[model samples]
Target chain A: MITVRDLAKHYRVHERAPGMANALRSLFHRKYKTVRAVDGVSFEIGAGERVGFLGPNGAGKTTTLKVLSGLLHPTGGEVRVDGHIPQTRERAFLEKITLVMGQKQQLIWDLPPAETFELNRAIYGVSPADFRETISELTTLLELEELVKKPTRELSLGERMKCELAAALVHRPRVLFLDEPTIGLDVSMQVVIRDFIKRYNERWNATLILTSHYMDDVAALCPRVIVIDKGKLSFDGSLTDLVQRIRPEKRVVLRFDRAVSASEVEMFGKVVERTELSATLQVAQDAVREAVSGALARLPVADLTVESPPLEEVMSELFARSRSEREASA
Target chain B: MRRYARLFAVQVRASALLAMQYRVDFVIDGMLSAFSAGVALIPLFVVFTHRTSIEGWTFGEALVVTGWFTLLQGVLEGAINPSLTTVVDHIRKGTLDFVLLKPADAQFMVSTARFLPWRAMSIVTALGIFVLAFVRLGRLPSLTGVLLSLAMLVAAIALLYSLWILTVSAAFYVVKIDNLTFLFGSIFDFARWPSSLFRGVVGFVFTFILPLALMTTYPAEALLGRLRLSTFLGSLVAAVGFVTFARLVWKSSIRRYTSASS
Candidate 1:
């Protein structure tokens, strides 16, 4: 449903030095530097595919999403949403896609969310029946019956975000570009948002491209992941592939009945973390069973559970590796 | 076109609902609108008291200009300023993304995003001023005069709205335009007086460059049956030209809108 080929969005930003004399000098003789916000990154997302875009701060994830949603004209290359060029922002193209930015909101501040939904209904030229159906569906799914009636400013952050989601979905957009949609929400609220997004995708068979620093959000919703760093595509594949490629190891966390020595755990696998009563061992994927059996047999393991490394640690390690590789290449 | 009309209604309803959201603000705004309308007339009353006529225009005739000025002020404050000022805020916060992503004309959406219903008090006050001016002159406008002035009223609104669009389009590049808008408002103060009050370049600037006369004086002159039909037609054409040009500028600004950091 979306195709981006060698897309780039470069910004020519003015440069100004600190201190009085330099500031004055800049007023007359200004300097300009072109920052490559998104340079030559390309990817295609098929219809109904929920893909997660992962990156650190200023990694061009948001910029790429903006290009796909037609908010910012790409400096180079081509982008198409469904069948229409995004930059043209033809009405039909816009009607087919919706962007939800968690940092920003579309709800009318002083008015009820219903008002915004009504406004979108008119703006998108949705039929009265369809509008009703969409709003009803959104309210039920998000449990937004009471939240929609109150002024947006009165709602808590989570409630407002719920309303924001409902407002964006009023037209039933087929492609959802969610940029940090669950940012700053509490864990439960984040889970709720994640679930609603998944349900929406499932119900509509919508194409979804989500950019979030919250790894849990991506883990729970997106089966495939695309990673961008420094305006370049660093990784793209299934989440499992990314994890396997970055850290092909399993974590065996053991709870001991008594204090366990680090040396005892290291005999089975590399000790990742440990405390007095518990220890975590990083064992290679293929040898995880042998390591767990060894640890179980050797240590007084009251309880043991094997799991994948935390996604946050895996992502940072991946980003760190990419940066170091770039440094090495340079 | 039909869809836009329905969309307009929805937008206006949202603004009206917003206006009523805070009762204190609604009441305060109503009071301010009335007070400002009275204050706007004070200079006219003071000038008329000093001299019955200035440069061939009697006090009653000039009151017609103030009347149209008040009406356009209504359109400016109620319809134009409230909506367009939010464009700067949108540009700052990057909320303009929501607006651009909509399946509608971005210009129409932003231009109608807000309205202050209480500001309609100025419109009522303008009508009152019109009635008083004509009664003092002891004559009603001619049928043709009324029709011409009505057309001029439409043109005046178009001119004012287009000028605002031009000012707002700057926000795309400059980002912070609070002072520029302040300068704009101060310059707009020129419209309260007769367009020909200033001589030479100042007069030329107000008449041609900024077209303040097209906004207020022409409509007043048309109402008083003192305006030539050709002049009215010319100003009408100019108003439409300004609108088209403003639309072009707005389109280019949107194209240049990089949007604030996400």
Candidate 2:
């Protein structure tokens, strides 16, 4: 549904030193440095596919989303969303997509979210019947029937975010660009949002590209992920593939009936974490069974489970690797 | 045209809902608009109490100018200022992305984003002033005069909206223009008097540079049945010119929208 080819957005930012004299002098004679927010990143998302956009801070994830949503004009390269040039911001293109920013809101503060939703209905020119159906479905799914009637300012952050999502979806957009949609929510709220997103994608066959700091969101909702680092596409594959490429090790956890000696745990595999009651072992994919059997035979194990390395660790490892590779190339 | 009219109606309804959201604020705002309209006439009362006329326009005739000023002030604060101020806030906070994402004209969206419904009290007050002015003159406005004055009101509203748009557009580049808006408000205060009261540089600037004459004085002259057809046509031309220029500036500036980091 979305195609981006070598999309680059560069910004010329003014520079200055910290001192008063330098600040004064810099005003008279300014220097600008071009920072490539997104440089030559190309990716395509198919219909009804859910893709996670992964990046560290300032990794151009948001910039890429903005360009895709047609908020920011790409400095170079071509971008089309569902067949229309995004920068042109044609009405049909806009009617087909929505971008939800967790940090920023579209809700009218003083008015109830219902008012904002109604306003969006008018702006998008949604048919009255369709508008009614969308709002009823969204309110039921989001559990926002009560919240919509309250002023937006009075709603909690998570509640406001739910309303924000509902507001963005009033038109039933076909392609969704979600930029950190669960940034500041609690764990349960995060789960609710992720579940709602997954349901929306499934029910409507909508294409979704989500960027979130919360990895569980990616794990739960997006089966495939596109990792971007330093405005470059570092990895693009399924979640399992990304985990395998970065970590390639399974973590085996053993809960001990009694306190276990560290030496006994070390013989099985690399101990990622250890405590008096349990130890986590990082074993290669091929050695996971052997390690589990050995740990059961040798260690005081009451319970055991094999799981992949945490998404956070895998992502950090991938970013660190990408940074080092750039340094090596330089 | 129909789509825009529908959008406008919805926006106005939203504003009305917002105004009534805080019940006490609604009543207070209504009373305050009426109170401020009364307060706006004090200077006119003061100046006229001392002289029968200034700049060859009688006290009653000048009241027409003040009435238009009050009405335009209502237009400014109620319809124009609130939305443009929100546009400024949207730019600063980077929430304009939501506005631009909508399947509508961004200019129309921003222009109609907000309104203070209570400020309509000033329009009512302006009507009352016009009636009072005509009563003091011992005659009613002719049909042609009323028709011409209504046309002038449209041009005045266009000019005011266009000027405010230009002012708010500066915020896109500079990031803040609170002082500029303040200066605009203070300068707009001069429109309450006849545009000819100040001659030389000030008069030239008001008539041509800033077009304060086009905003209020010519409209007042139209109401008084004294405005020349040529001057009325000139103001209409100026109104169209300013609106087109403002739209172009707004569009180009939107391209420069390196929207703040989300």
Candidate 3:
């Protein structure tokens, strides 16, 4: 439902030096530098697909989302969302998409979230019946019964986020661009938001593009992951594929019946972590079975488990590799 | 359009709730405005009380001008200023993305996102002052005069709204600036007096270029049984042109938007 080709968003940012002299000099003759916020990046998201956009800060994931949603005009690119040019911001294009930013809000601060929902209903020109039905569904799913009536300021961060989601979904947008939708929420609230979002996508077949720092959010909702770094597409594929490509070693976590020496744990493979009763060994994916069998026979009898490396470590390693590649290319 | 109206209506309701949240501040703002109005009128009332008229306009005639502007500006501030100035804050705070994503015109949303219900008191005060001035004038406005005045005032409001849009559109380009609207506010101060009171070049500029006079002078002049067809038609034409020009500028500014953060 979204196509981006050679997308780039360059900004002529005003450059200022520290100290009084530079600040005063800037008034007469200012300096500027071209900051490539979103360099040449290309990706496509199919309709009814939930994709996680992963990147470090300043990696242009949010910029890409904003460009797709028409909040920002890309400096150079061809972007089409649901067959409409996003920058043109056609009314029909807007009706099909919603961008929810966690740090910012659409709710009317002094008024109840219901008011914003009503305002959106009117602006989107949703029929009364549809508005009622959609809001009811959202309320039931979000458990927003008590929060919608309270002013936005009075609600806690988690409560306000639930209401924010409800407000954004009042029109039943076909494309949902969620930028850090669960950033500040606690663990349980984050799970609630993630589940609610996944359910919404499944039920409505909405095109969901989520950018978040929380790895669990991505792991839970998005089967396909697109990784961008330094305004470039570093990786784009399945989450498992990314993990395997970055870190081919599987983690063999073990528990022991009796205390064991570090040297004994190291005998299994590369001991990632070792303690008296339990130890974690890093083994190649091809050697995972061998490692498990070896540990079962050689180690003190206990429970053992095998799993892939954490998403966070895989991503960091991938980014480090990308930078080193750039350095080598340069 | 119903959508814009609905959006603004919610803002009005929201502002009412906001005012209730800070009732003491609302009372203080009202009292301050009333005091300022009384103070500004004292000199004019004193000078004209002893003499029958000033510069061929009677005390009551001038009071009508003052009262009309006070009312019109009260409405403008209550409805327009709060929301209008917020465009700058939204830009600085990076909160404008919400408005841009809405299906409605971004210009309309930014122009009406805020409604200061406390400023409603300005409407009441202005109306009271206008009625009192009309009572003092001792001459009921003719049918034609009333029609001309109403038409001119509506045109004035349109002119003000268009000007505001043109000014606040700068936020898209100069995102860090927080107080660009102050310049527009200062320039609009000239609207307090009738256009004829100023001399040749200044008067012409006010009537045509900036159209500050169109905001109040023309309306006040029309109500004083001095409606001029040329000036009225000129103000109407300018209002239409300004609205169109404002829309074009807004479109271009939106085109220039580069999202704040990656």
Best candidate (score: DockQ):
1
Query: Which CAPRI category fits model 1?
Result: medium
Off by over 4 Å in 1: B259-262
For candidate 2, the chain B TM-score comes to 0.97
Considering the two chains of model 3, state its CAPRI-style docking category. Answer: medium
Question: TM-score of each model's B chain?
Answer: 0.97, 0.97, 0.89
List where candidate 3 sits over 4 angstroms from the true fold.
Answer: A24-30, B2-11, B20-33, B49-52, B117-124, B127-137, B175-180, B200-204, B258-262
TM-score of model 1 relative to the true fold?
Answer: 0.97
Per-residue lDDT of candidate 3, residues A1-330 (tens digit): 989999998988789999999999999998999988789998888999999999999898988888898877788979999899997788999899898999999887877899889888878889999999998999899999988888888999999999999989988999999999999899999999999999999999999999999999999999999999989998889998898888999999999999999988787799888889999899999998988998899989589999888889998899999999999999
**Per-prediction TM-score, please?**
0.97, 0.97, 0.93
Superior by DockQ: candidate 1 or candidate 3: 1
Better of 1 and 2 by lDDT: 2
> With candidate 3 superimposed using the best TM-score fit, by how many Å does residue B54's alpha carbon deviate from the native?
3.1
Return the lDDT, model 1, position A87. 80
lDDT of 1 at B205: 96
Tell me the lDDT of candidate 2: 0.91
lDDT of 1 at B169: 92
